[model samples]
Target chain A: MKNATGIWALLLGLTLAEVALAYPSLAPAVFLLVLLALSVGKSALIIAFFMHLRFASRALTLALFPILIALILLLLGFLPDAQRVMHAA
Target chain B: MTRNETTWEGGGSPFAIGAKPLGMWLFVVSDALTFSTMLMVYTYSRLANPHWPAPFAFSPSIVQATVMTFVLLSSSLTMVWAVDAMKRDDRRKTVQYLSATMFLGIVFIVIHMREWVHLINDEHITLTANPWNQPLFGATFFGLTGLHMAHVTIGVVYLGIVALGTRMGKFKTDHVETSGLYWHFVDLVWMFIFPMVYLMSVKR
Candidate 1:
């Protein structure tokens, strides 16, 4: 409802930027970090604007996101094991 | 009891939104966790396998994926506009926007399947193996994108039903909004998948 066209434009620009960034030979870690940050930005815009989460109640937002983020972080804890495996290989 | 009843016994909506939309939001939350787990698995697999392949070339794969992203994003914008039209009680405009959204979704799926066929037929990438010799790349790539594609396919059918119901004076603004939530969620998932699956694997 808050003029999603602007948000759409921003999302498209971010996506294009991601493509252009991929063309460069950036370091793997740096490239990954930048891509993740840009993706988070795009997702935030989509959740806030298109999904109308921005108009949702603060209580609902609080009840929903924090726990979800925590669970996702917990899942991410397994990622370092992959690094260890890579080193061993 | 009336909706305005605000007793501690849960007589009213705590989230200040209707039950339907709230239910959809809960579903979105659960589904988000599912995708997150899959992505974690993908990242883990990629990192563990040092021979992970960045098989997608910019010519056909990345370019085609970019087009799919555009179509999906445009569908989301149209979905929100459909919700807006529904709120204004413009039933005709609502259906029109919804149809447009569905069309875009179909286009996205078509383009996506084309890319998949290219990979399978021309590039010899399957669910089990690929030219890169990293079987995990094919496994994770198809598993993730295939799951997301199924969602998009379901979403298109969901939007079709919502559109028909809205046109027949059955569904209301909340219904439109709920469907929009699902559509937008599908688009949001692509926001991550496009970059994680496609961009991160771009051929150097």
Candidate 2:
């Protein structure tokens, strides 16, 4: 119970930081990086604690880890193609 | 009270996580991939057109989306508390927490709907091309967020049924725990969507 409350506080702090970064004056590129990084931070906390992965065994963690890696790789693979199209036109 | 017996006690679950929870975890992973694909396409569309219109700025959608995020996050907290209450065999508190979670789920859906109405009616956005000529803008925005909203809607109904079952003394900790898994997964997805969709679109 105490831990859940602590996690909620941490999540809220991350959220506030994100809101601050969203201000129109902030550079879009910097905002994008910080916002996404904070998002990953927030997601890690939720997946680790809220989803009970923190206490889960290696078998469970190992099962889901590869999918995450593959999806990220897929994103990288798709990026340059989109950028190339943008550059051409 | 007799605890539920599992066939996996012998061999299937070497780690002893049990079949039901394991099944739930697998479902969550697959669902995560489904959203990831949609988000990937959204990223593709956003980058494909650097002039991709960000209609969220100068509108109420950002504020509304932030509120929705909080409502969903609060729902997630209630969901975990529901699981905790059930683990303690406190039926009343479990029902209370589940009900609160359901209410928050409904609140989230309502807020999102209002934002959509504002975008469509006042902002003149649609699933087709908006006045901005960024056709994919409305398409991806509504597509991804709509998918997540559907999940939230189903989650509300799912939690409602479970909450009712708990009120009638028809469920146990197992039910609440699984629901907690689903609810948290939904919240986790929104944590990504909130920044990816709303904040990133805010004009600079």
Candidate 3:
């Protein structure tokens, strides 16, 4: 991330957006969705640019891929709970 | 198999991804898993109990946390600048950037400690109980957030060592980049923690 300062500026904007949208006035579902989305985007930016993953070799990328997948899949696993499943009688 | 024919005998990069950085990457992934599992547990418990209270407020805690987040994010930027300086082999500039990063890191820890005091003393929250009468909430809150705070505290000290080593002409580009990787990983963890711990906990 040669443009280190610029990346910081973008991160600050996203963070402020998260704070702004997290207010009680906003609907809970929308607030959670937007904030989580923004956080994921911020993580991507940091990993690719600041962490130099973009310049990393294919082998390194492959090495890191499964860890990232596990995190995402953990969240996806919660989808059924968020869906409010019916209990078996 | 003689020493003369051994290409590895000479000083060369050990791994395809560069040995030091590859090791750092492994550490980052393992650390990520640690925090991720803690956070996922928090989420699961929070979801399991619909009545989980939103104890974090905007008055003192949230605002302070927001500032702390900014501090950490800014520190990451400074760390990157330090790496850039190292790339140019400018020891002076590298030291300056590293010092700035360390300063911001200390500032973050101070602000976080203050907030923790507020939460514990003023809010009467602890690992066991709080004003919310939801002890489980406090447990998860302190457990996860406390773990993250420990990381920031350790990072400050870690960067301090790197800064001193760099000033003494001990560290080079690879070492600086390795430290940068660690710092950025801590920031990345907070990027997720901030929203989950503070933003998501706010009442709506």
Candidate 4:
């Protein structure tokens, strides 16, 4: 099993990358993609290793993923409207 | 004597009381519903308002928030290690990992407080303040993030108690893994929140 230090290093590296990519020089769309990828990756790592989901039954693991998917669906569905509202306001 | 007074050293009834993990799962499910409702409200408000404010207009310091995210993430790592150590019967290592987990949780909460204070006192972005004169932005921002912060505070206290209890051997060996499940769930919620609340609106 991996130790906590390795996990911390991975999290730190990903976070620094996020901060660096937040600059305006980067394309906003590309930055958003990277951010989403990093967030999902970090989330998976925590859930699989820290949460012991990897060791848990398949049913339990499947149960958790749908809740996360629902959140993502909600975010994506509303984001466009949210952008329009901000522009209008 | 009451039936509850019966203590079987090693040969109790096969059907026992509620398992700790099952109890933890029930708590996690309830907590998940709370967050889901908040997120739903956030989505609904965003949909209704459309263009209430730009993300950067909020003036939250991205660097500080990102660092706090890392702290919380690292704490999750330590929490898992604590459980792993307990499974191996390494009490000292378990304590070490739990201590580290609790310390990181505290640091995250402290940084969160600093961010809130900076926003309220220096930035003057109160719950009543509206960007573009839209009241929904303030309400949604405060309501969603404030609710999440309350969870973080509760998690910190939970970790504190777990740390102290580990020292006193209050939890059986099996219970450590159960506690880890709850701690990890808390970390998972922050994973979503850090991006949605801090990073998502950065471009504006």
Candidate 3 residue lDDT tens string, B59-125? 7877888899899999999898999999999999999999998899889888988988888898788
Once model 1 is optimally superposed onto the true structure by TM-score, how far is the C-alpha of residue B168 displaced, in angstroms? Answer: 0.4
Looking at every candidate separately, what fraction of the true A–B Cα contacts under 8 Å does it contain?
0.81, 0.51, 0.48, 0.43
Rank by DockQ (best first)? 1, 2, 3, 4
lDDT of 2: 0.83
Model 4 lDDT per residue over B153-194, tens place? 777677667767777878766577776777777777776566
Over 4 Å off, model 1 = B1-7
Error of 2 at A56 (Å): 1.7
What TM-score against the true chain A does chain A of each candidate get?
A: 0.89, 0.81, 0.75, 0.75
Which window of ten consecutive residues has the lowest lDDT sum in model 1 chain B?
B1-10
C-alpha-based local distance difference test score of model 1: 0.89
Q: What DockQ does candidate 1 score?
A: 0.79
Model 2's interface RMSD: 1.8
> In angstroms, how far off is B184's CA in candidate 2?
0.5
Residue B105 miss distance in model 2 (angstroms): 0.5
Name the lDDT of candidate 3: 0.81
Ranking by lDDT: 1, 2, 3, 4
Q: Interface RMSD (Å), each candidate? A: 1.2, 1.8, 2.8, 4.9
TM-score attained by model 3: 0.89
Count of backbone clashes for each model?
Answer: 0, 0, 0, 5
Q: Which digits, one per residue and each the tens of the lDDT, describe model 1 over residues A1-89?
A: 55789899989999999999998888655776798899889999999888888988997899789999899889978977987898899
Instruction: Assess the local accuracy of residue B195 in candidate 4 as a C-alpha lDDT between 0 and 100.
Output: 58
